[model samples]
Target: RTLLSARAPVTLISTSGDPPLHIAAERPSAAATLATLIDAGAPLAMRDGRRQTALHIAARAGNSVAVATLLGARCDPELRDRWHRTALHWAVVNGQLGAATLLVAAGATVNGVPMPIKKHLKKTSLPLEAPLHSAARLNPASGAQMIELLLRAKADPNLRDQFGQTAMQVAQGAGWSPAQLSLAWEQQYVHGLDYLRAGSNHSR
Candidate 1:
């Protein structure tokens, strides 16, 4: 409040590449602070040096309230950072199920394609994947539930990444045993089938 009264720049980036809004969004008590910033005319869409908005930081930290607050402030949920990963992508990658749910409900793209980022060599091309792929490869413990949520959002399970691998295939190669993969797939398939059957019966 005092800073805002003093006309302090709220969008200034820190040495760690975070702005005040981004830092505020990372804390557990983010919602109130975020609201204050928003009320004080903080730029909700300002990107840090890493091109990550406060929404991105909030999603990555699994702060659903902050994510919701940012969304309500009209932050672009689809805005991608330097890695071309959106807030939804960060949420799923970090196993932030509540944040993911909020993002999905807000109409964030369930299967937003990631732009490839170059690694060691400029000549070496990296493969870009979707949010589900990141969830599968990076958040194994919650991967099944994450995938199910995405699938229910109409995400294309069979969509291939730049490496020509689907999320399931990536999961398999990421050391998910055959049994685990089969169980996850069967669960999702059965749930989807049941939903379809229910819809069909309702139409009758």
Candidate 2:
């Protein structure tokens, strides 16, 4: 009201070019400002300048409250950002089990392909990366834990990224070691469809 009454310019500031309404909606008391974003017709799945949505950030932040707000506001849990990562994908990559659990229970697809990210790799237009790829980059403990969460949600252990790399293959390449990837491979052997058996390099 004060900013409006003073005719002050409304500004949406985000370090990552995040949408202002989206940012507000992810806050502790975001409920206070949701009506405005709703009325203004904020883009439910629209990415900010950086191709990230508020739901994506909320998941990474492990903010269950904000996640519930977004879901209740009718935000699509399956919505993907530029990287093709839904809220659930980000939650898993950020080592947020609770947030990932909420999104998965809300019906986010377990088999949905996760988006990959490279913080400092040579930049390119490639988008074949996924949250699983990102998770595999973490230390063994966190990376392994993320795999467990995704698998529990029914994420396809046999899922191949844009590069045709399964989670097990990617983790192994990222130095997860054969021992760490064993569980993931076993789960795949159990849940993988016939399609998985047909893929090259799929045999355990």
Best by lDDT: 1
Clashing pairs in 2: 114-130, 115-129, 115-130, 116-129, 116-130
Model 1 residue 112 CA deviation (Å) reads 1.4
Colliding pairs, model 1? none
Candidate 2 C-alpha lDDT tens digits along 34-54: 555654566667677656677
* Candidate 2 global lDDT: 0.65
lDDT per residue for candidate 1 within 1-204, as digits (tens), equals: 777779888776679878889999999776677788888888888998778899999999998889989999999998887777789999988899999999999999988854434541243333477887887786456887888788888887666677666777778778887566665566556553344345446546
**Local distance difference test, each candidate:** 0.79, 0.65
TM match of model 1 to true structure: 0.82
TM for every model, in the order presented, reads 0.82, 0.67
Total backbone clashes of model 1? 0
Provide the lowest-lDDT 10-residue window in model 1. 117-126
